[model samples]
Target: MKMKIQFIVLPLITLLFIASSIAYAQNKNSAADNRNAIDRMTKELGLNETQRGKVEGILSAEQKKVEAVFNEERKKLQLIQEETRSNLQAVLTPEQMQKLENKMRQEGSKNNAQKK
Candidate 1:
């Protein structure tokens, strides 16, 4: 019984986690990617110190904006997920919910490992 519930919920949670992360998961590489782009642009364009500073500022601002948008979206997603979980709590048995939660934790760890 437990294994059945866990198997089902594990995959569903994994899919949801992927879907949620899709909206704003690039921040981990954003800084490195942006820095590389800036470096390439600077070298190709031969930007002076003043121009470089302006360009860096522009890039930083853009990155910040992107981060902000994603953060906001993630928050909204989190709220929706919480509501869904709460609603499920009404339908699922406590034992089933415990198994589901454990499965989710195991999946979360697996996801984190892949990210690293």
Candidate 2:
């Protein structure tokens, strides 16, 4: 039971950390980053209005694709996390599961506070 808990919880925590980091990065940069890239290209390559418009469209499409991919991956990760938690609940006693929930909540609060 202990080993199973460790195995499931460790990977779940790792996935959550990775997902949070990716979300934070996406929120921080976003569309402005795309516009900045286009601006840089326009300046460096001396692109005309038509070329600039095309590049903007390309960037916009790329951003949408990337966001879609991340969203899909995020949904998959969430499902995996939920499954792992359910499995853990099956393995653990009620008291142990409650303890685990409290620990996770505390950790989440710490993470949220740190982010602020």
Candidate 3:
């Protein structure tokens, strides 16, 4: 029924999402990278303190907006990930599930280490 379908689809979705996030992270331009653009503008334009302050305010506001959007998307992704894990438990054999859980834990730790 619906539950069986859910279990079968869950693993595929998880794999797809993991691959996509890896790709996205590799290609993404983070807000920190904006520092270079800001600096370049200041140098090329000879911005005075007043103009520089205005530019900083605009950039800061834009960065906040980007962060807000990222957070909203991340929340959705977390919900999907949780659902995937719950459904996968029903479909995978106990041994298979254990292997998957261990792999996920390893990857999680690796990601944390990389972040630092």
Let me know the TM-score candidate 2 reaches against the reference structure.
0.75
lDDT of 1 by residue, 35-96 (tens): 89889988999988898889999999999999998888788778877876786687688987
What TM-score number comes out for model 3?
Answer: 0.63
Worst 10 residues of 3 by lDDT: 18-27
How many residue pairs of model 1 clash at the backbone?
A: 0
Stretches of candidate 1 off by over 4 Å are 1-12, 19-25
Whole-model lDDT values for every prediction: 0.79, 0.79, 0.68
Model 3 lDDT per residue over 1-116, tens place = 64465456645655555654654563366555667767888999998889888998898788778767766676777787778778678777778677777766676556657655
- How much is 40 displaced in model 1, in angstroms? 2.3
Q: Which residue pairs show backbone clashes in model 3?
A: none
Reference-based TM-score, model 1: 0.75
